[model samples]
Target: MVASIHPSLFDRMVKLRRDLHRHPELSREEHRTTDRLVSELERLGLECQRPLDTGLVAEIPGASDAPTVAIRADIDALPIHEETGLPYASDVPGVMHACGHDAHAAMLVGAAELLMSRPEPPPAPIRLIFQPAEELGIGARSMIEAGVLDGVGAIFGGHVDRHYPTGTVVAVSGPVNASTDGFRISISGQQGHAARPHETVDAVVAGSLIVMAVQTIVSREIDPTHPSVVSIGRFEAGTASNVIAGTAVLSGTIRAQEPAVRAHLHRSISRICESVGQLHEADIQLEIEEGTPPLVNQGPMVEVARRAASEALGPERVRTMVRGANMGGEDFSWYLQEVPGCYVRLGARLADSAGYPAHSSRFQIDEAVLPAGAAWLAEVAVQGGRELATGMVDDLEAAGRAS
Candidate 1:
């Protein structure tokens, strides 16, 4: 099925992807990247809307809003510098396409082209959502606020997965990615001379104790069956040697798949911080900032995506996730909250050697997966659009009889 994609179109995608990789942009700053996408999408004679400062919404007319099925692709880079040494490496110093968002946007455009060239439109319109700020964990919500989901019935999206080999796609039915939320602990106490140990309430000691206590939240407070994480990524205390610091701070993130586990982690962290502070005679303040929710694919939408993968690349190539649910967070969950949709991982691993993971300076994907990703996305749009249109018609009929 991949071979059926015109060689010229595939080559165009490869070249354009390299161009994007050459000059990458960070979250919410994808102006150049946005311009390039707008040009290509307009050339295909599709309607375009710049719903956000960067990124766009390209619409391909079909049966006139019969039931708009959406396909989303993120288009933001990372802060890491390029280390892959490819000829098309990042041109901007200290910035790179470390997460394969470049490839994502490229393949999405390829899908748009393939759909545009069809002899006739599908049973419904298709909305191509080129979103920015995905790395900030807010792009999906930003687009939704801009009315991207207006009149939309179903949506489909995917990410490049290095764990699986190229030519394969993993479509999971539920709980694919975990929720991400962050917390900060501030400790305040007395400061005094180093010699006056009893005179000072050492915040450093209190902060250290708090960090250790935070670890027990996942291990003891939460159920062992439900996987959760409490990681203190940053800790600050003490100003200089031989000084009892009066203030300290600890910051970290929380990851959990289930709602109960997520809430439990938050509660346990607060309890641990307060208890530790009281034990050490220090004032403790805790703040938790909510981020994206866990991505749980609906069963019916998963079937649509899985069948699309099978039809696009053959039934043998389509597969389910081999590992358990991942702890990583994706804002795509925000879209699923608004409407039913399916999210899959597009395999891009080239060899057994474990290459640099996403967000690494050396991160990269197998370019060969470009066309495969495109084909899968295009197929899902066609299949999902038809289903949504039929359902919409059925609903209208039921309403008419009642009226």
Candidate 2:
């Protein structure tokens, strides 16, 4: 029978999660939170190194010299004001851990505690990555730039989802999330009086036309089989009622799962905006800010995660996802871009906490999943270490070639 996680580790995880939820900080600004994590990891006797502006890497040496396995937890919170009525709600106004990074951080720390308690180290070294600025989608990249994965063989992480019960975990092989990119359009025209229709190029009208035309790019230009999203979420124009605004700005985002689709979306958005500007006789300016890439999990690594989750919880509580890629993007994708890795979703919902989404001030996760998450991470480390030691990646590649 699989051993149950210690009771003390479960209690510690709950307390740490609550404390982090209460004193949340924003992206790239997690000073106090970083300090607390450093202390906890050090107490567990892991070799620690702080590389990024507000992040740290803790190394747990194993019994052998196999490739290192890294597990990441984002520590940054969001800018939302707290609305949750819990007694341990965010003490800092205008800042909240509504996205559940606090829970991730606490869970990884609990995993460190459990792993450190074994009589000897496991087969391979374990890297505990406390990443900052994940909400801005740069933490993983920053960590990579700092050589966090210099010798790492694989990585794993999990996000909290309210769609499932607290004991459940959802994961799958291949692309799980989409690439997110942002765009801004500036339309310039001649300002004129509202009553004088023919004298000047009204930017408000031109911008409206451009907005309506932009929608056709997705509906008309792209292939129907490939999923894509282009949302003009924000628009700005005239201030006074009598005068037509000289300029208008439109800002939105693009999301796609495949690289070819992502490139097509970016190219099409620019082409559509420029075409609309020429058609409306307005000077158009376009800017695209690229975000994270799609997270594609390696098939073998995904099986390891599935087994770990099933070992910690019951088999019924662990599932392989069947749905297509999610539009939401993650910085963890940065790590996957360079190495073979798999990221999972841990359910944090209780029966009473339905209808609330992440990043809202009212967001709260079921704390009962704390032990389950920690136990799964520990199991993944154990299994992944063994796989790396046995040359799993090479064997899998050879089998793919033979098949």
Candidate 3:
């Protein structure tokens, strides 16, 4: 059941992907990207709506007003200098589509083209979400607040994965990605000369102790079976070697697959900070900022996505994540919190090069995945729409029987 896309369409998508790669935009600043997407989508006669400042939503009309099936693609780049040195490398310094968002956006546009080329309206409406600020993990929430999901019953989205071959698709049920939250700890202590260190409470020593103690939260406190991480990415203190530092600051991220583990991580960190502060007789403060939640794919939605993948690309091409669940964070999880959805990893691994991870400067994708990804997105929308419409019929019949 491998659907064939026109060669010309694939060529156009490749061109579009290259164009976007050359002019990569950072989060919340995708005005030009938004304009380009609008132009291409409108060319297909789809109505576009600006639900936010940077990102926009486009809709393909259907035969009936059944709940819309949404397909999402993030349209933001990372703050990395391009080193691929391709002719179409990013023109903007310190900003590149190292995460393959350029590919995601172009594939979505390709999907729109395929859907619009169909002879008849689909079984239900389809919404294409070109989201912004995904790297900061705030785009989905903003779009949701702007009512993008008003009529959307089920959503489907995917990221390009370099770990698998280009022809494969990973659609698995259960937690696929971890929740990402940030924390900051500040310590204030008395300062004194090195010769009189006894009179001063050393903030550097206290902060170091706190950092080491926090590691035990994952290793000792939380269940080892449950994957969790507490990493201190930044630690700052002291001005001169001779003086006992009076202040220190620690900042890092917390990640966990389960909500219970996430909460436990926060509590344990706060406790460690307080205990260390009291022991050192210093003022220590801990601040936790919440980010995206864990992305757990619903079983029914996963089935829909798998069916779509099997139909669009052969069943042999469909696969699950060979490595276990990913600890990385994705903002698409926010949508699943409100509606049923599946977030998949589309294989875009390069055959020649040992692939670089998503946030690396040297990362590249197999361009062949563009058409396959577009096909999957299109088929998933159709499959999801049919499933949702059938469920609606089942509900109506059940209600009629009850009456």
Ranking by lDDT: 3, 1, 2
Could you give the candidate ranking by TM-score, starting with the highest? 3, 1, 2
- What are the runs in model 2 whose C-alpha is more than 4 Å off? 1-3, 223-225, 322-325, 392-403
Tens digits of lDDT, candidate 1, 213-237: 8877888788887778989999998
Off by over 4 Å in 1: 1-3, 400-403
- Among residues 3 or more apart in sequence or in different chains, the pairs in candidate 1 whose N, CA or C atoms overlap within 3 Å are none
Displacement of the residue 267 alpha carbon in candidate 2, Å: 1.6
Candidate 2 lDDT by residue in tens digits, 107-225: 89988998899788878889999999998999899999999998898888898877777767887887778888898989898888889967767788877876787787779888987
TM-score, cand. 3 vs. native: 0.97
The sequence of per-residue lDDT tens digits that candidate 3 reaches over residues 96-123 is 9999999999999999999999898888
C-alpha TM-scores of all predictions? 0.96, 0.92, 0.97
Please report, as a residue range, the 10-residue window in candidate 3 with the lowest summed lDDT. 349-358
Highest TM-score against the true fold, candidate: 3
Against the reference, the lDDT scores of all candidates come to 0.89, 0.85, 0.92
| Stretches > 4 Å off in candidate 3 | 1-3
Q: How many backbone clashes does candidate 1 have?
A: 0
